[model samples]
Target: MSNLPPQHASEGLSLADQVAHELREDIIGGRLLSGMALVEADLVNRYNASRNTVREALHQLGREGLATYVRNKGVMVRRLGVAEVRDLFLVRRTLEIQAILGSKPLREYQSDRMLDAIEAAELARDREDWQAFGTHSLRFHQHIVGLLRSPLLDAFFTNIAAQMRLVFAVAPDEENFQRPWLERDHEIHDLLAAGHRQAAAEGMNRYLDDSEHALLDLLSHPTRA
Candidate 1:
């Protein structure tokens, strides 16, 4: 593989952004694994970046709850404890159900956008693209909430998405696990667009329940890094 200096890695991306994006991908894709130690000098040599830049990048990840920095021991990729997993799903359930129930009658165009997000998610899943799948999956749900037209709901869902990213890191075969949801999500969007608000809400609830169950099942076997 060709090695490029981190400072010149990509155009239009700051050094800190480049470092953060690279490390974030490693964390989310399970390449770095949970609780893996993040050494500054090692990363600095690996990315050919300055220590200051690496620290700034790690700070960003830390803020997202993707990593934790400890004095003397340095930083490590954050893993979701069992309780953390339960809390994440609980919060997600509350936000999503509210979004669905509060959504106004969906118009045709609005429904189309929702369908588009589902299709994107499905395609990403088929390609085993975990990063794309996670992002598109969040978009699918966020679009459902967007129908509600509430800024508070929007912000809540956004934070939920970030937390879900950590969960995705622990899930086995995340793409395969998300496939069914993608199909069901498309149907839910169709139902809402058809103005079947009650049915849409019901479908959303079932989706959340099943998703939470699956994630919990996966978490039952937390492997060491």
Candidate 2:
């Protein structure tokens, strides 16, 4: 069982949301493996939350594709198949490329966030903090998507980012899985900073293609976690 950080009863977030947040962290952090059953009773005990809260949290996770409910089997952490992985990358590539192509000339705030993400990622890599590196990498792409100022798009990417974490968790070598992308992320940032919008978009497309290939390769060959 995962030990969640304590939340005060008076905290502003709803009980369900609080439970969901903790569960999401466990799922992303790999404490809860893919396809593991999420028993409502277990969660209620683990979180000291009401049955209703646990149920609602499961529903929210289902909505995010982090968990799925089967009529007879109840809920379990989601397992992505090869086709799902392919489709995810397809949608991600399209959305990201559009964000890149549509990005305006370097607004200082946006550029700073992008550059900060890159720098943080480098630091995380140096420390061999794969989880932090992954977070920063997602932040880097998120800032790119943020350029469009579309809340809807931003939310979509956020959901995809969560799913991507599950993929990374099952990958063979965490460090190797994430290592190559650090430089690629910097390249994309540099291209955009230099005001080469088209070039940046193209670079993003190639980056996504390479990422998809690597992820698919890992998915096709399961490694014992």
Candidate No. with top lDDT = 2
Q: After superposition, how far is residue 138 of candidate 1 from its true place, in Å?
A: 1.8
Q: Model 2 over residues 1-225: C-alpha lDDT tens digits?
A: 445455634556687877887877665455676778999998888888889989998999998889997778989889887887887888888888888898888788888999899999899999999877887888898888898899888867877777777777667677888888989998998898899999999999999898888888787777732
Cα lDDT for residue 129, model 2? 92
The TM-score of predicted model 1 comes to: 0.70
Against the true structure, candidate 2 reaches a TM-score of 0.83
Model 1 per-residue lDDT tens digits across residues 1-225: 214445545556788877777776565444676677988888899888899998998898888677897677779877776688788778776776777677777777777778787778777777888667777777778777777788777756665565676677766566567666777887787777777877877888888788777777778865522
Q: How accurate locally is residue 126 in candidate 2, as Cα lDDT from 0 to 100?
A: 91
Model 1 lDDT-worst window of ten = 1-10
**Which regions of candidate 1 fall more than 4 Å away from where they truly are?**
1-64, 70-73, 223-225
